[model samples]
Target: MRAAGLEPLEPYPGSGSPWCCRHEACGREVTPRLGNISSARQGGCRYCAGKAPIPPDEAQALMRAADLEPLEPYATSMTPWRCRCTTCGSEVSPTLMKVRTGGGCRFCASHGFDLTAPARVYVMQHHQHNAVKIGIGGTAGRNERVNHHRRSGWVLARDWHFATGVEAHAVEQAVLRHLHEAGHGPYLNRDVMPNGWTETFGADLVTPATLAAIGTALLSSLPVTLYCSGSSAGR
Candidate 1:
């Protein structure tokens, strides 16, 4: 009938692409595999190597659920996504199409791109309030600095040098001020900033320690950031 739930795959319905014997009509009837639809008439199936008859309507429904409509011509090919790319006019490979969320191909990522600007979020770890370390991910277009780091031997290098004047120090102050105004002080959410989210933001605000606790936190948790402006912030 309609194939035992999941027996025969789509496109190649009705004809199981059988192979057959060709011993000069010795009364043999082996179902040989189906031939290339383009050349089926001359090449035939598995048993007798005959033609792969067109699939009946029952099998068509199965193909439909697989998002493979417009059957009948399926005998020519089995791939579900047999279409041309709208952009480059190239044949979109079926393998690539299968991985996407919807029924579109890889070209879908660029076809209807939204070119508008995206809002940016800056992150840095804030400690007792003296200094901070920054980390950044990708370049936010031409305006933002590219975050990068290089290591030599045991020492690690954190450099956020931008062709544009995106010095991290100034940006750190701005972020600190913004955090201060937001009353988001003494932040315990150091987990959210990630390893090097502030690199693109530029540099940290370093201030002399006013108390032993501040120095201990700064040295021990070298990970946490200083929240105040550098210089005489000891007050």
Candidate 2:
């Protein structure tokens, strides 16, 4: 068996049968039902072969369907690429397979926020526009959350911290609903932002008084754990 390129390892036990053959080429522990190791054909790693390099065109098409335009020349599907994401109009580098699998802007997703952890609700302001966005960032820390938005050309105006994810989500909804009812539709300068779909409101409309009122309403409606007094001063 060793002369035939089969590396014999410990005997593999099966129902009423045992095999004494193993292949190191593919790193498989046991060769299923080997009569004689000599007749067993040597096959290369099946796992690597299954992950064959994907064609550039197919990868491009997959990216296009996900509203992402490749920034670099297309390589293999595994290559990392800088791409323009239409979902948030941000330049992001993600693997071809990730985009193909319906992955979207990382900033918008809060860098895969962990729902099981405490959530931080923030009030972010647009650098060049008179707008503010109220949002939630889960276990993905506040600094990371702000950095993601900043990389996408947004500036963090304020961060409203909450003790739990539930509190933040509830308050965020309250703020959005209040803004939407006020006819701003929870978006300020919506047409100006590139693919802007974040929950935002006009700077003039999102005054300190308005935020206080909305926060108070949320505090009353939600559990006692929901606190709004710890909000950072607006920038």
Among all candidates shown, the one with the greatest TM-score: 2
| Best model per lDDT | 2
lDDT of 2: 0.61
Q: Give the root-mean-square deviation of each candidate in angstroms.
A: 22.5, 18.6
Write candidate 1's Cα lDDT for 1-235 as tens digits.
Answer: 1111112223453444543333333343334334433344543222233223323353344334444443133332223434455544544333212322234433344432121222112232233332333332222454232222222111112222222222333333344444445444432233543333322221132322212223333333333333323221221
lDDT tens digits, residues 178-225, model 2? 776767764544355543344766668675446656766676776636
lDDT of 1 at 104: 40
**Residue 145 in candidate 2 has what lDDT?**
63
For candidate 2, the TM-score is 0.44
What's each prediction's clash count? Answer: 42, 0
Q: Relative to the unseen true structure, what is the C-alpha lDDT of residue 119 in candidate 2, on a scale of 0 to 100? A: 69
Query: What are the Cα lDDT values of the candidates?
Result: 0.32, 0.61
